[model samples]
Target chain A: MHGQPRPYWNPLVAGLILGLALLATFLVTGHGLGASGLSARLTAALGSWILPEATAANAYLGGYVKAGAPLAGWITWEVLGVVLGGLIGSLTSRRFRPKVEGGPRLTPARRLTYAFVGGALVGFGARLARGCTSGLGLSGSATLAVAGFVFLIAFFAAGFLTMRLARGAWT
Target chain B: MSFPFYDSGFWPALALGVLFGLALEGAGFASARKLTAQFTLRDFSVFKVMFTAVIVAATGLWLAEELGLMAPRSVFIPTLYAWAIAVGGALIGAGFAIGGYCPGTSAVGLASGRWDALVFIVGMIAGAAVFAWGFDAISPLYWAAPGPKGQTLDQLLGLPVPAILVAMIAVAAGGFWLGSRLERRFGGPIGSSDVTCGSEGAQPPETGTRPGSMRPS
Candidate 1:
């Protein structure tokens, strides 16, 4: 959708901006950016609406619904912001377009299939560990959360292994 | 005092989250190829942006805490557990490679009109369900080695937070340098052809195509 593959801003500069944003978050909100937790919450809310009694009884689903208004929660808003932010960024960069993102040698369907499988694993892992890369690895590290460290190790190890297996997808 | 306005309830947090997400999009971080470039050692944007933000925020937090403006204890910190993190991280990493987007990025991807991102989102939700259902069976493994919520690298290594943060900044710089060099070495020929998505004016390089490297004529 854009030329020059849409020039990227300098990483250092971008990082600095992100830092300020985070700092602002801390100052006004006393926290950091997060994504996965809310996704779980949304899932729980939907599950409950579909089967209130069962969802309420389910351990994980129960936690999110019992909390009430999963979509109304702070993290969920942040996620909404992420969506808006991404759209704006892509549009401004002239890089916005609807397409399947994947490697060569793969059809859109295949790429999407892999995306689904991979995303599922990530979701499971994030929930299993109580957080994903953002909550555990990034935010956790920011606050010196020990579980965050372990998550970093496990996540990277898995990525490396999967990368090897998915070599053809990339090449 | 009593910051984290949303923590007090919900609306404020949701607003803040959207703002943050907007910021991420503005930063052009929603793209998967851009993120994976870090792994290929071609682009260090991820490290650069992530560490810069971490260091800057850490410094500000430290200053706030030192000034007694904010109680460090009040700040939320993820409790540490070796086992849960290890297994979770590995799986997440694998998912990153296969899916080309993390939980956060997938949202961005979806916003940018990527149909595949939707699929990934569905997959993630399913995965979370599976994990939640199996939690009862895996309870023991999840709780292994619990520690103080704020236990960190500095504490474990006997270094001060500020010092460690500085070291991290330096490390990030080094990574960026390496990434640039790799890009120069591997970036295929530029302008070979930009793939367009649908009728979009001009498609940026698709996932498989490496930037900064020469594209085969």
Candidate 2:
């Protein structure tokens, strides 16, 4: 397996591990997993950094500021852990490499642009919905939250419906 | 009050997050191509992993509650902000199709050294800032009602938690079966065969492959 990344784990096996991890999260924190919330907080912190008065004056950013140090939140630390974990997994699997991922038809620049635009959309939408795939779909659904199911359905539906427009980028 | 773990501080959260990230990367979710394949209907790994995880967690949570290990009320559940969630979900879906990475997976991708993932993260932060700046204007849409507070499937359907969990497991099983069939029909080798891990400055890989030929077991 030298110079070759190991094949991905069986989906069921990986999912089982993930499920147990989520169970652990619930049992310990009385809360589910999340990703976007930390991003939102980081963004608010950035806002406050550049423009303190306005950031504190804005309703949304201000709320985060009032909550104390944005990076001090548990979710922020969790996200940091995620990055570390990913690094460990990639290193062990020998998949760590700096590269742009895109279809042959997509130039590296175009792919990067699309990634940024897509990320922005995700950021905005997650805040609007108050969560993302992890928060609303995985965590919420696991706990039988109605919003989780609704989000799961709506998310896939929208993805399927609009995928054609972006087909070239991936396909 | 049934569980005293929340008071244990941030270490537990961090450790769980690490596990979550490891699971995601181990499942090949660090690859943008693999993730986007779900939208293309060419691969079902995304659906498979997600549904399985959901079912497993849901079952475990339900079992814990039944055994009196934890109170259902102690778990944080999102309140239903119906229209906002629907609209937001749609936007997220579109982003997923376009970007091929979500907040969680993007972090993994970035860790695995994907340059695009870093750009995506920056974009995400900018988008969040835009939302913050426009919160007052968008509050109505974001906070739209017809929203019930903390509604769960069991409560909504007037069914027992176990019954709901059973239904969810059934759905997951059905989904997995269908996903396998789809993979057989549409799956192919990911991108170009020349593309390998840890190859920086490599050219973009060619798209698609002969259906049913390169499906990973």
Q: Please report, in order, the local distance difference test score of every candidate based on alpha carbons.
A: 0.69, 0.83
- Going through the candidates in order, their DockQ values are 0.59, 0.74
Q: Distance (Å) between predicted and true CA of A143, model 2?
A: 0.6
True contacts kept of each: 0.71, 0.79
The top-ranked prediction according to DockQ is 2
Question: Which candidate leads in lDDT?
Answer: 2
**TM-scores of the models, in the order given:** 0.88, 0.94
Model 2 chain B, TM? 0.88
Q: Assign candidate 2 its CAPRI class.
A: medium
- Residues B1-217, candidate 2, lDDT per residue (tens digit)? 3762674367877798899899988888777878888887777778888888888888988878778888766788888898889999999999988887889999999998889888889988988888888888999998787557789998999999888878877887898888877766765324322234335442544434454544223
In candidate 1, stretches whose alpha carbon ends up further than 4 angstroms from where it belongs are A1-6, B1-15, B188-217
Error of 2 at A133 (Å): 0.3
- lDDT tens per residue, model 1, B145-197: 78765777777889887788788778777866776666677662111123334
lDDT agreement of model 2 with the native: 0.83
